[model samples]
Target: MDIVSVALKRYSTKAFDATKKLTAGEAEQLKTLLQYSPSSTNSQPWHFIVASTDEGKARVAKAASGTYVFNERKILDASHVVVFCAKTAMDDAGCSAWWIRKRPMAVSPPRTQKPLTTRVALSLPICTAKS
Candidate 1:
């Protein structure tokens, strides 16, 4: 589908069917898309945490509490949540901690490739510290 079509179809959902969930294939596709999504200077300094299980979602919901209280219910109701995190730094070491040490080519669909090296930090659903 075209970008305009996709954009037009997108809307913010305050409520999500609690019983509904994305299939494994659908979840993988979403992850791949987020990984390969373009960024300025190809910095690719982002990491993603997918919370699909009840325990995982609860953890995210806990972080969403307090100042982000309004997002708690929406997060719990959703089948899954993707927490996109930006690295504290964009240097080679920082990238290596999450992404490849060497510049790596973006992987396309159909083939599932392990694109990153390792995760440096635990999943923080709502990171509020100033950069």
Candidate 2:
């Protein structure tokens, strides 16, 4: 489908059926999708916390209090809640950590090494700059 068509079909789930839950396979698929989602500069600086149990849902719902109270019911009734968190800034240490974690899976031709390093170096300031 084209981007416009997809956008037209997109929607927000205003309500959820509390009784229904995601199957293990469906949940795993969702997690895998999140893991492979693209990121700027290939810096996968994000974390996802999935809450599937009643207690976990309750804990997650707490954040919906006050101004966000309207979302509490949705959060509580959803079969699975995924909290997406991202880093506001990436420091040297954070970069090192990310590199270490991604090193094993990062495979590239020797010819691309210099350009890859340059790209990362250029993007670091943008990622780390405080807004």
TM-score of each: 0.66, 0.76
Give the per-residue lDDT of model 1 (tens digit) for 58-118. 9989988778899999899898899988765443345443333233563332335332322
Best by TM-score: 2
For residues 18-104, could you state the per-residue lDDT of candidate 2 as single tens digits?
Answer: 989999999999999999999865678789999999999999999998999999999999999999998777765676555556575
**In candidate 2, which residue ranges exceed 4 Å CA deviation?**
100-121, 126-131
- For all candidates, the clash counts are 0, 0
- The positional error of residue 130 in candidate 1, measured at the CA in angstroms, is 23
- The C-alpha lDDT values of all candidates are 0.67, 0.79
Candidate 1 residue-wise lDDT at 77 = 89
